[model samples]
Target: MAMRKFLINFNYLNNYKNQAVRFLTTASTLSKNSEVLNETATELVKSIVEEYENKGKMFTLPWVDQHAINSALYPFKELLNLGIQPEFLEDACLHEEKLFRSMIKNGQSIYKMLTIFVENFIMNYEDSIRMFAKWCDLLENETPQSIQSRINLFSGRGLASGIGLRRIFEKCPELLFGSEVQKMDICLEQISNFFESGDLKTIVNNTPHICLLDPTELESKYEYIYFHMGFVSEELAKSKCWMDLDLFSIIDRHSLLLKTGKYFYPDPKRPQLKKENPSPELIFDTPENKFANLVAEVEYEEWLIFRELCEQQRRLEDKQEPYEKIKPSQRKAFERRLKEKRENMEGEIE
Candidate 1:
């Protein structure tokens, strides 16, 4: 048992060494435009790695599993502070431009795969906010300010700004900390509060929503939100839901949504620019996207009532046509009367 434990420890130490090397090497070439907060974080991680090496502790590769990496850097706390001004990391963090160029230049499918995953994420959350915060934490070491800024940029300015939250959660639900529902609700409440004192109309109208995640996942989540929120038909919802749930779904969905030409911002200044500091736009929507849902509910009810009526008629007739006894015109009349009766009954109590 002692020998086995030693082996595991040895492996962990090796991993940490590798991660330390990677972080330092990466930091050495970090762009001048890189966020100071993130750079500080990078420095912190490097320091921790060096300390572990000096102490003869085995370095864990990837560093996520290392207690020293987690504690010294403290993702949740440090990232939250950095978020206050995340724009500086534009050059340091891998931008979408490079992400796409890598895939296209290499003829790879990583971008597409990520999108489908993101779309299903929104649906899974039933569109809440808290879930998104947890997601951001897990996916990247972003500052809380950056997260909020991104959410505002994507969702527009309003009490119902959910695009940013949905976008992040969809892109990387695995990265977020909490269970799907818990995080989603939190995200929703926060966005709602952001718009509480302001006019939402200006935010959405001017800002418009954008998917900053890799295209595939970004598209998938966008479509999922559109479908479920009644922006698209229910038929589309089922298809999108399944498609968005696949691995690399986020990457795939993000691509597809952009392809559609339906989702776009009117502002030409920051077109396709996924920067933390955005040119502010006045395009907020009140109860954003809520109307789409109401239309969906109506469609759902119509289908449900039609199915129920068919079942009732089938049982009543024992497989024969219930109106067979009536003449064609009379049968039409009888059906119409029954439909009204059903409608009235449906309205009366339930």
Candidate 2:
């Protein structure tokens, strides 16, 4: 006897004859306690019934016998002959061992990606599946976005790359899973490490060189690009603003610096030298630099707040009003307070 696959949709009944045989005959193999599995089965049954009764489509051959149809449908129905719920069928149908086995064999990551693709397209379950199937077809040869891609997206730094990986993940958790999104700094940290370790040699060799610049400044102002563009000539190029500098390292860096000149650092440690054609290796290789950034932002904020409070107290003291200069101990206490406040208002405890 051949195994059967349940034809969850009418289209599948028409499109995938062999797969349909496997679907129904294969049986559900979900765990009894699995909510996703239970929901999937419930949703499938509901969709099937809705498509058949409401649409008035005639299912031939295997679906012809009303008695067999009723019996087949019985497993999905909740009530029992004795007016008691037939718990066994529910467990057996939804938890069908073979079904779960097949699903596992096909790989869950694809399904997870499908879930996200569906949300991105704002599609229903069946439609989502179809869309994802198509998406996979298009992306079959494309590489999935990496953590660096995600960080760049969140930072709003990779605008022209069309790298919406993070957005897709956020709106579709079913497609992507990671602790990194919850703690974006983690992604940054990982990237930092990769660069710190120089493991990104290949990546650097391949991508535009200017990606090495600090993302914060790149995001803040566009002048940085022009500042560097001055390297090419005194007459700065008109800021097309829309230009995807990623294509030209010289253009991207020069334009970004020109746009945000004040923020651009002549980091004394790595002062700019005459470019006789820079190497791609100048780009930082660490996968992420988020943790260091998280640290800097927190400390910087604390410094700003403390400095403000000190100035306020100093002004009162200058008037002989008994305000004391903040001591090291007091500063430490205030720093802790500011750290907690920032974290509570934003993210991650550390």
What lDDT score belongs to each candidate, Candidate 1 first?
0.34, 0.33
Model 2 quality (TM-score): 0.23
Native-referenced Cα lDDT, model 1: 0.34
Model 2 misplaced stretches (Cα beyond 4 Å): 1-104, 107-113, 119-121, 134-223, 226-350
**What TM-score fits each model?**
0.20, 0.23
Off by over 4 Å in 1: 1-39, 47-133, 136-336, 339-350
On TM-score, the candidate that comes out on top is 2
What's the CA RMSD for each of the models? 21.0, 20.4
lDDT of 1 by residue, 249-344 (tens): 322222222333223322225434323211111111212132122322224444345446655755776844222233435644554564566457
Q: For candidate 1, which ten residues in a row score worst on lDDT?
A: 277-286
Candidate 1 local lDDT, residue 212: 17
Model 2 local distance difference test score = 0.33
Writing each residue's lDDT as its tens digit, candidate 2 over 165-269 gives 333433433322232343444433433332322322222223322233444433222232222221211111112221233323333332222232212222223
